[model samples]
Target: MKKLKELFTQVKALNYTDGEDVSDLLWQLICYSPKMPVRLQSQQLLDEATSFTLEVDDSHFSHSVLKFNGFIWGNGKRKVLITHGWGSKAADFSDLITALRTIENLQIVAFDAPGNGSSEGELSNLLLFARATEVVIGTYGASDIMIGHSLGVMANIMAISETAIKPSLLINITPMVRLKENFTATMTFAEVPQAAQSKFFESFESLFKVPVSYFKLTDLYTEGAAVKHWLAYDPGDKVAPLEYLQEFLAMHPSVLSKEYAATGHERIIKDAGLINDIVELVKQGNKQGN
Candidate 1:
């Protein structure tokens, strides 16, 4: 890691001297996401799952054709789409998959984001994940139920807000608002060079052509999108503090939310009560015709 930081320093120097931008190197650093290892239990669940791979329509970018690796379970009336967050994969929802199976004739679809799980790609970002999500929703169904955690929540929001797809229910765990603070905090924790911070955003913006601020979940359009929204998270989550959703909750008074004690950031996705809350919400949504 120290060597990588040192290389970033050298790259920053070269970026300043020569006209060449460090966006490429900085791109690799920022988007270099590590994949989560599939647990034996998760693997056991996946063994029964029907896997799939769908190509994303990312022709507007120079990235090679990317595909999402996912699994489908059950063949019921309503469909559910599950997504995992940073460093986590679709199989992390093995418990939820089991719980959802109790529903008579329900379809559950989940996928790994590019560069995460079994999906192809060496690097990934919020946009890439969101685009992959759009492809999955396109192949599956537009009016399905969508569940996301952490960064996955932002990706789901981006996918729905930018497209005509209107999911019935949007379930979020550890929902966050802004990207600038989190991005800077991540760079700081990774010991990124102060000079290289701006360079990385330069690269990110250059590729997306839109500013990094566009990734903010709160700013994304949700009107006439998911008619029902529910959030389950711990207030003490440092990665996505309760305050992050304060503005959003206040703005959307009717948005349903429940706070947990100390499930940390990622562990809330596997919380039993959280899972029950999710299942219950879906049941209610079904009853009310969400």
Candidate 2:
């Protein structure tokens, strides 16, 4: 994978037309995929599972349907689906998967969204990820709880809003609030020129079939959700900083927001304490619902 910084250097040196070319290249590069060997921990979880594929609509591309990869663990009535973020595979949730298994009669499912891990395709976006998630939910019949990290949280939100799947419990860890804000921040960080940024938005809106302004974290909650919502973040997180959700959280007083001192973005997902807290919350909610 080419470094975004390196691409930024190249993008910075170009004229408008040339910069547009590089901008397109940079957009493709931003759609990250796994390159390293799957961790033994993640591999172990995969080994104990039955895998399946779901056909998803992809009208934007030539393919009639895309096969989304997913795994099922345990056979309990209680259903939980977990999703990982950009550049990460389902195996990144190995710790949480293992932790959740301890819950009696609990069925857990996790999948590699398109252009990610074992899933098909070379480039993917939020819309694709959400559609893939919607398919998994349909196959699972119903989800009692849904957990997501980083970009996965946004995908989950979009999936829930756009589909019939209404998980009873929603957990978002280090989620991005304003999609456009983050996109612009990323472009700025990459040193993408002003003209290139504008060109990229035009390209993005054309491809995604939704204006960037159409995406807002608040809209997910505003669309009417009776389900329990949990938002967690680490103050020190560099990736999806906690401050991003401040205004959104303020508007939605019902959301349960929690803070951790040193967990950061990546480690928080793998943190034993954090995972335990999440599982405990799920269990507690289960008891309350009963």
Candidate 3:
């Protein structure tokens, strides 16, 4: 709990007016700080995981970069692309990558988004994320499964709409069509002060090293018009409202919707049962030629 509180404190203090400077600070703190227990925990997690090879690809979209880590599981005949959420690195889903490796003929690729992890670029909105995915799919020439978490899920939806790249299955973990609730919950969870919240755009600009106008959340939703087949997993939690999930389902009936009782937004990914269910769904979709 103390460590969680420290993380909350650090999140609350995130300055957005000068994002490049803030990014430098964040890098220094994450890479070298001894006081950050969360960083230590993350490092420990990474150290325990099986290492993969890093590959870099330039994005066709300006101000964007793609950095992916490939983990060849089994025969590597089938490929799966997994994307992480905001403020998360590609290695955050290492557990999932490791577990999926057990299945033969499956290859796993996890990419760090433009603003996060080792990827280069200033902060990017959902459109840029979609474009990055398009570039990855076009470069690889594969249409396997695509799994996304939180904001990454939103980007995936937009990407499918904007690009011809279609995967056999689209799995969204704790996705939200609108981000207002997510922002509210994040602020509450991080205990961000009202004053800080008022300066959110400015702070985000600084934190992401992007222009304030580029942080607009609505643009991402507009670009999400192309998603038809999808799976949405929403736990009864504060991060995303049931109404939001329902709205997404209503718009896309082909979406496989499930609700967990106790699993919150973050834990839903860690749930083995949920993962198995998703894997099964993908297999079913493949069998049905979906």
Candidate 4:
């Protein structure tokens, strides 16, 4: 982290120099997904699950084959898939995972996104993460529910939209909205030059084969869409603020929404009350399925 901060300093200076190509460095900076340490609480749940891997040809990485680590707990009725956001691993959802089990002896599947947690790849972007999600949903039946936090919400929605794989419910915890605005904020944090910003987007679009504008959350919403959404988020979340969600909320005012406070963005996924709501929603989904 210290080394990366030093590089950030260098990049900030380079951002001012005329005709300097900081795009490569900036690309690497943005793609670099830092892995968080697994908590002791999460470690116990992780140890109980059967560990597996899926070898994928990630086109975002020039069709490089990468092995992604996954975990599945329980062996009974119904299945639920849960995923964490950027810089987070499957184990981070330990508390929610435990509560979910109480709803049913559900075979819960969770995986670390490429370049995060125990997964392979040195760098990751939304395209790569969404691809991983689509692959996972393709392998496992998208039957009961798909639960996600932050960027995981984006990836989950992207996967379902691309594959047209319908889960019983889509539960978003601190869901991310407004991609272009968020990207601009990220560029500001990275100290990327306005000149280099355009270049970075060009490189991103080149690698992913789609402009950044192509990844809108609104794409998942349509008239008479069967899949339902249960959104739980704090209004003041700095990472994905209420402002970012305004457009989506305006478009679909009827989607099940829950407001939270003091939970912040990152830690809200593990909130006990939030988990209770998730369980309740899943219970309702199960009943509807039956």
Candidate 5:
């Protein structure tokens, strides 16, 4: 983390002659993958011998296709797909996966999104993440539940709305409600020039092909989707604001939410009780669906 901070600090100190290039560079830095490796114990659960791949359509770079890497564990009747957040790989859900493995006849799968982990790409966007989730669900063909954290929740919601794979239950942890809000915060923290902020937004929109207005979490949930949602979050999260979740729940009364005191954005998954609760919810939803 210190190294990453230093790298960003150096980049921020650079004197760029071209403002457009600087904006592009900033966007690239945001999109660039900071690959997270799976721990030894977590790697043990993964069936590295058998792997899966998907082709991601990269529209920004001449519509090129990128490869996405993933692994599947267990061969149970019910399927649970785990999606990690920004700059996070599938194996980050090690603790959750360890708990879920005990559930009988439950198949668990996870993947590294394009430009993340071992995936083939240099840059990624929300669309690519959504498409990757969709592809995994489509291929698996029997996803009963989905567990997502932060940006993973955003991708899951987008994939659920856009694709045919609607799971029985969705467990969203520390979900990012608004991309524009996040971007604004990021710019403020990075100390990006006021003149460069607009350029960054414009460049981002052009590169990702999605307007900032369309990036809200509320916009991703479509009515009549046969999915019961559980939202778990901590108000103290530094990256994603808890007020966003509050605002979303206000508008969408059908969703259920739970709050933890100080789980923050990243460590919520580390809670064993929370993982067990998620498993229990999935079981209940599976029974209800059947």
Candidate 6:
């Protein structure tokens, strides 16, 4: 307990850069220690505003569980499923959900991905993430528009390709084509020590607690085929490379792309005007469908 608290204090005191690689910090706190209480507290923090359940399914290669939080608007007829990025929880989409709630015809469903928040499973695999999404949408009666952020965008893309159920429209925020550039840049800019970098990956292996390979967005494009109107937003943020936006537009010419002037990756979700624009697009899509 003393060691855990000391570790937390050290992490909090570190003068971490804007894009500092905290994988080492996480490694010390989570993987190296058997601090169940600390892990539980972290999980609680991750799920602070999320209310959901664990619906487990064992039929798959490794047993997977879905963690879903739903908000019913009006008659609860129309539903939209929102997925968050790496290390994010269901509540991360609250701002978008609030904007969406203004439209009475829609309900919102959000979930924590495996190994991140209130979900079961210890690894973050694109295939498993996609499959979990399929299961959740199916369980929710297929009345949804899939909205995903970053990694979630790739997962949703894979989901559409793997599952029979399709969302009426797809909204991908700060989508990417590959993580090579972003990862390399982050590592270089953060100036993670060689020893720490090696330990960081080792920690990832231990912390994930499951077997799954990290996926490249190019892999999704190569193996995917889905036809749905796409609304993509990419700001000149450090987290997502500019090349990703360029490549995405090049590959999918039909995507409605918007580049925010000053907003970073996280701010895009909370931008009122941008959120309103997305809401309008969704409404337009619904009207066209009708």
Q: What's the lDDT for candidate 1?
A: 0.77
N/CA/C clash count, model 1: 2
Q: Per-residue alpha-carbon lDDT of model 4 for 1-290, expressed as tens digits?
A: 56457657776777456667677677666667777778888998989998888877766654688889989888756778887897888998998888887876578999998888988988787777787887887787664678889888888777777887677677888887766667777778877767778887888788767788777776655533436877888988988988767777778876678898989999998788898888888888777863
- Give lDDT per model, in order: 0.77, 0.77, 0.58, 0.79, 0.78, 0.60
Per-residue lDDT of 214 in model 4: 76
Q: TM-score per candidate, in order?
A: 0.88, 0.90, 0.64, 0.92, 0.91, 0.67
lDDT of 1 by residue, 53-100 (tens): 898654434457887799999887788888789767988888888898
As a whole number from 0 to 100, the lDDT of residue 105 in candidate 6 is: 71
Give the Å shift of residue 264 in candidate 6. Answer: 0.6
* Consecutive 10-residue window with the lowest summed lDDT within model 4: 218-227
**Candidate 6, after superposition: displacement of residue 36 in Å?**
18
- The 10 consecutive residues of candidate 1 with the worst lDDT sum are 9-18
Clashes of 4: 0
Model 3 ranges with Cα > 4 A deviation:
1-77, 120-128, 184-232, 286-290
| Residue 180, model 2: Cα distance from true site in angstroms | 1.5
Query: What's the ranking of the predictions by TM-score, best on top?
Result: 4, 5, 2, 1, 6, 3
Q: How many residue pairs clash in all the candidates, one count each? A: 2, 0, 3, 0, 1, 0
What is the C-alpha lDDT profile of model 2 across 53-127, one tens digit per residue? 887766654355777788989998878888888777778888899888888878899998887788777667777
In terms of lDDT, model 4 sits at 0.79
Error of 6 at 66 (Å): 7.5
Task: Note the residue pairs that clash in candidate 5.
Answer: 76-105
Q: Kindly list the per-residue Cα lDDT of model 6 for residues 1-96, writing each as its tens digit.
A: 476567667655656554667765644543222112224443443344335454535333345454433333334566678877765656566566
Report RMSD (Å) for each prediction in the order shown. Answer: 3.2, 2.3, 6.7, 2.0, 2.2, 7.7
